[model samples]
Target chain A: MGNRSKDLLQVEHSHPSSSRESSLLVGKNDSKPLQQKSYLQGNPITVPFPKSEVLGKVKDFIGVISEANRNLRLYAKDKPEEYDIEVLTGNESEYIKMDLMLGIADLHTPESLAAAEAAIAGCQSVINRNSTSSSLEFEGSSEEEEDEEEDDGGEDDDTRQSGSHVRHKDSELQQDDFLSALLRSHQKKKPSKIIELSVQSGSDCSIRSMAMATLRREGKRLSPLISPRPIEALRSALVPYQEEAHGLRYISTQAVRNRMKSVKSIQKITKAMKMVAASKLRQVQSKAENSRGIWQPFTALLGDIPSVDVKKTVLVTISSDKGLCGGINSTSVKISRAIHKLNSGPDKEAKYVILGEKAKVQLVRDSKKHIELSITELQKNPLNYTQVSVLADDILKNVQFDALRIVFNKFNSVVSFVPTMATILSPEIVEREAEAGGKLGALDSYEIEGGETKSEILQNLAEFQFSCVLFNAVLENACSEQGARMSAMDSSSRNAGEMLDRLTLTYNRTRQASITTELIEIISGASALEG
Target chain B: MSSSAAVPFWRAAGMTYITYSNICASLVRNCLKEPYKSEAIAREKVHYSISKWSDGKSEKPTIRSDVAED
Candidate 1:
């Protein structure tokens, strides 16, 4: 079995490899000799070359210089006692030249090289004074030699213990020097840090003045580089304060007054809006109650009919165009989306007929392809049967559908409403049921005149039903919108009142604090005069 | 009995009456002829009711009735 398996594997592998070898041989036969002959006859042959080689070399050169500069900077920072400025500057120049010869040195600009040298020089001098004061004996030791000596000493216990006492004293002095050098370098690197420290300390006026003078000098020198001066940055940051010492008190009072005025005005507007919405809610609620008679029975009838095999359905979503109606519009939109999701399949096509601007704006963002028609400005005035009839007629004439589903917010109470959906069967479905004498048995019993066919009568009935249902849905939605708006405005007014209370409390406390400070100043002045 | 009593009488009767009225009204309107028929059709085509609150100007609400006047 093992031999047979090996034979099968060999056959499978050999078939592709042998075919690949034959193809390679054919490929060579056609062009290999011609290419070699061209090369021999001194004719140029085209060959693809990668374009990134030059860029790659430039990047590598930059990387090497940056890495060397980083290492040298770290050495200068960590072990200032072992640093020799003159030797370091000389080695840096030589290393750079060697790297240039090796095709890796691209730091050719004078300014950058000068900057590197200046940074090294600055770092060297920072620790030079401290190192010279303490480590005069080890001053001439190279960095690598010192490291090697330390490493070798670590290997032998006798030598290590003998050197520990001297090393400890040296290290103590080195720590002080290193800390001072670090502070100096940090001050130079970020002048702002020193200025902030001086300002925060506040006890030493002489030091702050000196720091300011040095920052001014550095700012002048680095002006071409656009480095922000510490003094200038501080001045800009404190620009809201006046130059005069007493101006701060007057500015605080004026800012407080302005804030109080704006908050008061906002509170007034929200209070007025809340009152208006509350008054309007009553009328809208009554209208919604009256319209319940129109839609409730139709919905009941619709519920009795069994679900049909509908290919196309029209979804009519009712909402108000205005905002600040809480989540009424979003509720209708969510219901429509869920219904659309349920009806979505390969064979089912759902088209949208939106009634208000709010739902149109939302559905258009995501389901623009399904929106067949959108009717706006319906909420500018209160909805009535006449407007809805015209809307229904327009929808009926424009689109063909087997069923129509209406989505609207149903007013349950003044504070709450539910997003509801109701369906209306098309005339064709009613006629089919009548013919079959099955689901819509009650609809089949209705008598028609001699001139009108059963289907035409059913069509007229459906159109009338659609208008009535749309009118009811719009009324209910409008009522819900008003109720929601009233509650939302009430809550906003309450929140604004709370905010006003907090602001007034803050304003009064600030006033009292300023008053107390002035009184204390006067009392101190009086006591000093008496003394 | 209390739940049934809670429902208003007009609500129970109004739905059937309106549905029947609408069907009858459309059928009767369909039998009319000439200018009267055209006027009735136009009137039935668009309906407008007065809003409770006037939005500044007392102008009637704008209507987009493009039902072919035929």
Candidate 2:
């Protein structure tokens, strides 16, 4: 194997392109001519002849020589430009000299072959020695020390087996000594001091042997048999243990501690928010209560009039702009959608004038077809009469409706709110009702100036009533938003507190387990030393 | 408790009442068939402001040429 690989390496170094060509020419019948052509170019040999073939053919001496001589003479005479006789003779002489130097004649003899084999073996041994020393130098000294220790332990085991032979002989000798001592003691039974001294020495030797055995056992226990390499062991000792389940690794103690800290801070923030919302709710609730009284007379005036003939209805959905108010905005949106659904028909078309972005975002998704106008940022500050009036003006100018239904979350309690709807008659509706003279009987009771027409009074009353109802709805929705936010923040703070407790318990348990493991290791080490 | 503070309180209340009466009067005037109803509504439309477009151009021209262009 070595010789073949070496020959291939030499071929590769000498004729890399020829080696590729030869590999391509392999197993083809035309390979012989290709090989000869490549050999004629610069290579000295095309194919190496086997020793057996060369030796076997050598016996056909004169016939083969005369045939080769005649062919060479003919070739030289016919093509003197291709072959030179003097150069051929010089190459022949060099070849004969090389063959003689290599002992080609004595190659068939056993003694010369043995000598050649011994020379080759010596060279191979030298190469092997050099390769092993180079490899050992590449591997560092720490590995060498480990190997040496392993060798020493193996040798010790072997010596222990051999030492058993010597131990057997020593035991026989000790037995003989014991028999002699017994006989001597029996002969001199009054020598108690010497016997006591011998017994004490025996006990001391037994105790020392027991201590040595325990020390060896502890050493073996400390250095486990399939131990990791030193660097790997150090890394494993430093890294914290991680438990993986269902492809999810458990968070480390420090990560859990950080989460707990963030949750604690969040809990504090939510608690403060809850307090602020509670204080703001009181002021908003009172304003909402007063606004209801302010709009009561107008509502009473409109309530007496029956609704006009069915036409387009405008839905005014009121919700706060801000979120984290527990589902107050969603409840208003849902109630508006329910109203829109209930009032939908072939003759009656529902249009929406959404207030606040929360309801707009939701309504625009599914009810964009019904939405006529969306007003936002009105809830940034407390709702005021002027803002609502501007909004009502915008609605009145842009949209036409028979009835305007205001959908809003009504403030019920600090922890609860309900979505409510209130309807205001449009100017046309009030005109139609006044013309009917059915519900306008109540209006006739009020004395008016001779210049003031009843229709003008009703129109102004309708517009004013529209703005008043919208203003009341806005205030009520604002109060409800604060109350809902207070309750939401209260619950969020409670949940955060619970999560913090859980995380703290987990952190404490992990720390306690680590401490206990360290204590166990120390105690075991102390007991091992004592043993 | 003091007459000066009471004066300001009455002034604020009177101001509120005046604003309210003005809004009601304007609403009543804007109603159809009242004085200057069409012109008042046209003026309201011209002055109406939209959040999206602020050029203050009315949707339609109020004035037109009586003579036909050649």
Measured by DockQ, the strongest candidate is 1
C-alpha TM-scores of all predictions? 0.52, 0.51
* lDDT per residue (tens digit) for residues A65-111 in model 1: 33544565478679864554324543353211100011101111222
Residue A414 displacement in candidate 1 (angstroms): 1.5
| CAPRI rating of model 1 | incorrect
Model 2, CA-based lDDT? 0.55
Q: Write model 1 residue lDDT over B1-70, tens digit each, in one string.
A: 6423422442355333234445557788889987788777665554322211122222343456434433
Best by lDDT: 1
Interface RMSDs of the predictions, in order, are: 15.0, 12.4
- Retained true contacts (fraction), each candidate: 0.08, 0.00
TM-score, chain A, per candidate? 0.55, 0.54
